[model samples]
Target: MYPFLRLAKEFYVHRNDPALPLTGTHVSHHLCWPWDLDLWMELNNGRTLTLLDLGRLPLARRVGLIAVMKSQGWGLTMAGVSVRYRRRVRMFDRFHTRSRCIGWDERFIYIEQGMWRGGECCNHALYRAAVTDANGIVTPDRVMRAMGLDVASPPLPGWVSAWIEAEAKRPWPPMAE
Candidate 1:
């Protein structure tokens, strides 16, 4: 299950939130439901990624990305992601997620997100996302313009830049053993 109801609840909860600048952080709270657990009785890795969406989508809404996409007939898609998990989230445990756009390049936007419990980070993820329309991928410049912003992207953090560089060198379709 994709938790559509929870997403709707989140939208309702933050409907009145102030609009955020391109890089402003949006934070959302969540609980670890029993169904979100794996065999070890902690949050499953895949579920963590799915749960992070609860934060990411709200961030997109707060920043007006969703509205722009809808109006421009553009779709938002994740091109790549890297995640780190450092702590356990047992059933019923409460946590908060923080999400923000780190920066963008000509073709892609980079987002940073983290899950925290009791003021400690439990996991973090970096996402490479794209905006697309009928032709193909839409440039970040056009996306920004649609959102009524004319500013340039802040420089991408070193780690995110490194990841982009490394991904460039990786063989597509991957190599067979």
Candidate 2:
């Protein structure tokens, strides 16, 4: 199993503001395609370390990370994503991306991620993950249990929780809207 704490720490370290400049443009230019792993690979300069790479960072490792977090009695999920790109990453460019747990609530967890190349910000993304099940139903407690964590009523950080609540209220644009 993957170590959740270590992954979480690594993710957190890469979060930043997407509107910032990377190279010459704002990070928004890099997000033209969402599910393109090739673009991600290119961004990393023919190397591996893209979001898909991170997502596939050994399922066992991710499961272990989730297990550790659940053991702490915290709720989390992988819900939705919003990414903005600033510039096109070319071959041989070395970049870094960070993810951070901004907050959470009864239904979702809010994460902020940022990508940088050579000290310039390249991309920024906000992810909203649902605390749900395979059927896509909200069940934070059950999800926690599935990870082998004993449930607790521990208080969450104010900023983290508040961010989730605020994000939950935003109206998501429809696919054809």
Candidate 3:
């Protein structure tokens, strides 16, 4: 069993738009590694807290998020992510992230996530995920069971089909003739 699966109870759901930065403005730089101020605000809650520094919080929170579907027996693996930024964020700012399930198929699940500041949407993103096993292996049936998703049969989305086909044709080396 995953330790995070147990620690998930520590985090409570917070719903409220906290103060954030404006569009085209540069706030505190280097607030965290790998991600700059804007990216941080777009992806995080804008608190001084760092996902990495939070120790068990990250895994717990993520596990909690997954638990929603996992309880339904669905396995999830991040497939693709696309983000759009409309504003910046500064120090001492507070905000909220809203996540919702949009759609799903046998092979994939779709989610829409957003970052809000002061009742305005500063950033939005869509995620494509698939179910996997404890070893990070894709097992459609097992994933569905883990997430508790009910379906008479596996469904395939057109986009997912296209992506899979494209990936299958890609050459091992870019310059390979």
- Which candidate ranks first by TM-score, i.e. highest? 1
List the candidate numbers ranked by lDDT, top first: 1, 2, 3
Error of 3 at 61 (Å): 7.8
lDDT of 2 by residue, 57-174 (tens): 2222333434444454543445666567786665555555554544444655455666776677766666666654445655545545565655552455575456556766877774
Model 1: ten consecutive residues of lowest lDDT: 151-160
Off by over 4 Å in 1: none
**Where is the poorest 10-residue window by lDDT in model 3?**
20-29
lDDT of 2 at 41: 50
Model 2 residue 116 CA deviation in Å: 1.0
Which candidate would rank higher by TM-score, 1 or 3?
A: 1
lDDT of each: 0.95, 0.47, 0.44
Query: Residue 169's C-alpha lDDT in candidate 2?
Result: 88
Write candidate 1's Cα lDDT for 13-119 as tens digits. 99999999989999999999999999999999999999999999999999999999999899989999999999999999999999999899999999999999998
Clashes of 2: 17
lDDT of 2 at 114: 69
